[model samples]
Target: MKAAMIFDMDGTLFQTDRILEASLHDTFQLLRDEEKWEGDTPLETYRDIMGVPLTDVWKTLLPLHPTHVHERVNDVFQDKLIQNILGGMGALYPHTEDLLSYLAERGFPIFVASNGYPRYLETIVEYYALDRWIISSYSIEDIDSVDKGELIRKVKADHHLSHGIVIGDRRSDFKGAEANEFLSIGCAFDFSQENELREADVVVDDLIEIRDYLEKVK
Candidate 1:
């Protein structure tokens, strides 16, 4: 049976922790300079909220400030994030290009299924020239919700894929795969809680492990 491999973008394919943290820091500072907030929220405190939508982030943080202040802050934060991406400030994880190329050479049907915004996904794929390696890409914009499992199911149906797997750094990735009866591989090199990683069908700390697993499954 042919196998389709879908990967998550943020912590899975690219190491955006620093970039995101820095962007948030710049955004909060900009808000403070504009007198939008009296103080800054630490980046560490916001790490758990990283993959969440911007609108949700605003809603969560808005309680700390007047409701009238959230709209402007959200606008400024988004502007700064866009600027950061366009400024050539972000980077992919180590060995990502090599791993992707390896999969492409092996004729694997590889796709990027991510919760990231569509524009950001487009920018990163173009910037990395990943179009050559990836068969397709999907973002949260393609779906109405952030449920990764639902997105995987949609991909499976749309592509007519019968067998496949998901590789990601979060427990939701594994749960999504399980929901669709697909194998889940947790990436240990990326950020994930220990309990979350334990739920994966397999766990690996390197890309070569994925290549090996694919071979065994085939």
Candidate 2:
């Protein structure tokens, strides 16, 4: 069987940071209005928490807040994120569509493994028409697990995949593939720190490079 491709949504395929800033601003405003948050913003930026699970994101941003507060923030942030996505406030990275089409044409089965919420994942796939190229997508919300490695195992079993590659811009993505004994291709042009992708089997500077590398290896 052809090797499948599992992608991470945030910094790998979808340019989430583009929409997240606006959504975060709105969420902070709402929280202030309702007296849920004390300050104008959290000490750390969203970039600092990128590629981690949502619960960890909450822990990082609201270390002193309770579970209910985190849930409330998540709800508001997700609402705003979906609105921005539908409104065309974000985009896939340059050459991403072309790369996906290239892989699709070669009969590579593509899937998404993300830490995003259910509605957030649905909106992204539908709005971007990613279902056209992707065989299926899975998120932490779907599996009720924070570990991307476990998430990868679930996808592989459910889809009956035997061989595959993991692609993303973070250490979690590389670690997931490593745990599954699959090759990992890290996208270096996105949100990850310089050393974050050191463990990746391969590193790429652009989306088109992914296509080129895969073609040579396939």
lDDT per prediction?
0.79, 0.87
Position 209, candidate 2: lDDT: 94
- Please give the lDDT score for candidate 1: 0.79
Off by over 4 Å in 2: none
Per-residue lDDT over 105-210 for candidate 2, one digit per residue giving the tens place of the 0 to 100 score: 9888999999987789889999989999998889887775789999999999998988899999998999999898888999986587778888899998898998
For residue 62, give model 2's deviation from the true position in Å. 0.9
Expressed as tens digits, the lDDT of each residue in 79-155 for candidate 1 is 66667767877777777888888888877788988877777788778888989888788987698887888888888
Best by lDDT: 2
Q: Name the 10 consecutive residues with the lowest summed lDDT in model 1.
A: 45-54
lDDT of 1 at 204: 85
Q: What TM-score does candidate 1 reach?
A: 0.87
Number of the top TM-score candidate = 2
Instruction: TM-score each candidate.
Output: 0.87, 0.95
Report how far off residue 205 is in candidate 2 (Å). Answer: 1.2
